[model samples]
Target: MAHYLPTIGFGEWVTTVGEVVHFTGYERPLDTLKLADPRDVKLGHLLGTADMIAQMADRCYLEKCRDRLYPEFVLGGVALPLSANGDRAIKYASGLDLLRQTPEFMMETRKKRLDQTFNQAYRYIEPLFDGTNPYLDAIERSLDFLKQVLRSESWRLLRRNPQVFAAQPDSMTNVRGLMVGYFKKVWSPD
Candidate 1:
C-alpha cells in the first residue's frame, strides 16, 4: 500500500510503497524509484536539481514569502502578540495584503529569499556540469529567466492574483520537465 505523506510545495505528494517512493501531483509522472540502476549517484543529483528548480517555479513561493515568512519577521510575541485564548494571532492573508502593506519591503524580501535559495543552488550546481552539460546550461538559463521575472511588474501582479496567470504556462516548470527528461535520457544500463 502506498501511504501518502502530507502535501509539500506545489501540492506534491510523497508516497512510500514498501521500499519504493513515488512523486505524484506533477503534470508529468516522476517514478524515480524505477530507474534501471536505482542506486546510481547521478539519480540523486538529478532529483535534487529538479526539486530546486520546481521550488523556485512554484507560485506558492510568493505566498509563503509573505504570509508565513514576512509575519515571522515583522510580528512578534509583543508587537503582534498571540490571542488571549492562545490562538494564532497572525491570520493567513493574501500576498496582496503584504504588498499593500509594504511593497518595497516585500520585493526586497522576495529577492533576498530567491538569492539565498536559488542562487546558492546555482553556484553549487554550476561546476558539476563543467560547461558541457546541457542540463546545467538549461538550469542556468532558467535561473536567469526567473531573476528577470522577479524584477518585472508581472511578478507583482502574480503575487496579487496568481489565478490570472494560472492558465499561462510557467517557464521554470517547463525547465523542470526538461530536466526530468534529461535525467531519463542520461540514465544508461551500463
Candidate 2:
C-alpha cells in the first residue's frame, strides 16, 4: 500500500531545493554540480519547484497511503521539522486546521485558500465525489500527454481502475500481490 503522511513531500530525493542543487547520485554525477552551469534553474524557482513538487507528491501520496496518515504526511521521506521556513512549514501541516500556519502559496487563512462561491461544496469536495480533482486530473493528464511522445511507456496503476489493459475475470492478478492476498481473506467465501 502507498504510505500516506499528513505532511507534504516533493519530487523523488525524493527532493527539496537544497537536495536538487546539492544532489549526488549514482545516476546524475554529483561532481558535476560544481562545474555545471546552474542555468535553467533560478534559486527562487528551485525552491518553488521543490515546494510545488513536494505539495503535489504529498497530495498524491496521501491518497495512496490510504488516509491512515491523513492530515499529516512527509514528502520524499522528508521530516520538514516544525521550525523549518514557511516553504518547509507548509510542507508539515498535519491538519487542514493549521493550513494557515502552512507556508504554501502565502495562504494565511482557509477562507483564502478556498475562494469560491461554495468553498467546501464546490471547490474542495465536489470534484472528489465526481472524479474531477485538479491535483489528480493534472497528474493523469500530464502522464498521458508525456506517454504519447515517449517511445517506451511504463504504465503504473496503484489502487484504481485500469483502463489501458483489457479486462479479465482475474483482475486481481493485475493488482499488487499483497492486495491480492488481502482480497483473498475479505473477498473469498467464508
Candidate 3:
C-alpha cells in the first residue's frame, strides 16, 4: 500500500521542527546574544526537502491544486470574471467545471500559480542548503505529471460523468484519492 500525506497542515510540522531546532526564522529574537555559536546551528530548511517534495509530487500537491485550493480560489471570487454589467460572473461552477471547460488553460494557470508561490516562498526564506533545491525539480516534475493526467482519457471520462465518478464508494470518502488512483493507472511515470 502507498502512503499519502495530508494536503493541509504539513507546513505546521515543518515549523514545529524549526522551533525546536532554534532556527533563525519563526519569531526567534534577533537582538539576543546566542548561547551557542550561530555558525554551529544548521538551520533545517523544509521548503526544498526531498521526502516532503516527493510525497507532495506523489499526490498531496496535485490533489490540493485540483480539488480544494483551486476550487476555493474560483469560489472565493478571486478567479471569477466580471459580467458585461460589471457584476462578477461565475464562469465555472467549480474547479472541476473550469477544468472540464478548458483543461489546457486551467492546467497552465495552476502551473503558473504553483511556480509563482514556490518562487515567492523561496525568496522570502532563502534556504541555506548548499546543494541544489530538489523541491523545485519535484514540483516541476509533479506539475508535468498532473498536466499529462489532465490530458488523459481517464480524466475525460471523469469529467464526462462527474456525478457517476463522485458516486463511487472510494470517491465518497475522498474524491482526490480516487482521482490519484485513476491518474496512477492512466499515466505511468518515467
Candidate 4:
C-alpha cells in the first residue's frame, strides 16, 4: 500500500521545535506541491527522506536492482504533520536508478545532462555530522534499524520514522548486504 504523492505542502507541520508555524502565508506549498495539502507534507517528506525514498526506488526496482538495492517498507498511515525535521531526499527513485544505471548508462539514457539528484541529496545530508540534527538522526536511526533487520532477518522496511517493520526482502540485495555488514559490527555485536 504505497502512497503516490506529489509535492509537499507548507505549514502543515512545524519545521522546527519551539517555533511558531504560520500557514497564513501558505503560498510556498501551494506553489510547490501539486494537489498537495500541508498536512500531507509529512507523508511527502517521509517519501522524500533519503534512505526512505532511496529504499522506495529500490523497492520499485526490487526485482531489477535486487543485487544492487536493499529494501524498504511503507511509510506512515495516520496523517502526521510535516516537521521542519523533514527527512527529505534529493529524489530517491531517480537516485537508485542512477546507481543501477551508472558508468554511463543513465547519462547515455538521458539527454546527456548529469543527474546529480543523489549527489544533491548527499550534499543536503552533509550537516548531519556534528550535533543532534533530528533529520539526520532520523535517517541514521532508520539505517541502523534497517541494518539490524537485514542482518537478522533479511527483511525490508515495513515503516519508517516512528514505526519500523521488517517483512519481505523487496529489492536491492547489494544494499541489503551492505546494511547487514553494519549490523554485524554495530547493533547485534555479541
lDDT of 4 by residue, 109-185 (tens): 12221123122233344466654345434434544544464456444443322222336554344445655564354
TM-score of each: 0.26, 0.21, 0.36, 0.21
Quote the positional error of residue 139 for candidate 1 in Å.
9.0
Worst 10 residues of 4 by lDDT: 72-81
State in Å the error of residue 25, model 2. 16
Model 1 whole-model lDDT (C-alpha atoms): 0.42
121 Cα displacement, candidate 1 (Å): 8.0
Tens digits of per-residue lDDT for model 3, 96-171: 5554444455345335432332233333333655545555555567656655766673554333222223445664
Summing lDDT over every window of 10 consecutive residues in candidate 1, give the lowest-scoring window.
16-25
- lDDT of all predictions: 0.42, 0.34, 0.44, 0.34
Worst 10 residues of 3 by lDDT: 39-48
- Candidate 2 regions with alpha-carbon error over 4 angstroms: 1-36, 40-94, 103-190
Question: Which has the higher lDDT value, candidate number 1 or candidate number 2?
Answer: 1
CA shift at 93, candidate 1, in angstroms? 2.7
Task: List, residue by residue over 1-190, the lDDT tens digit for candidate 1.
Answer: 3233433342232332322222211223343344444443233434444564454445454555544444443333322335889644543343344433443443442354324322333345556667454543444554454455555645653343343234546743554455445435434443
Off by over 4 Å in 4: 1-34, 38-46, 49-101, 105-122, 130-190
Better candidate number, 1 or 3, judged by TM-score: 3
Candidate 2: tens digits of C-alpha lDDT, residues 79-188: 24344343333343332322222333322211332232112222333355575556434544533433342334222332333232346664434444434354355337
Task: Identify the leading candidate in terms of TM-score.
Answer: 3
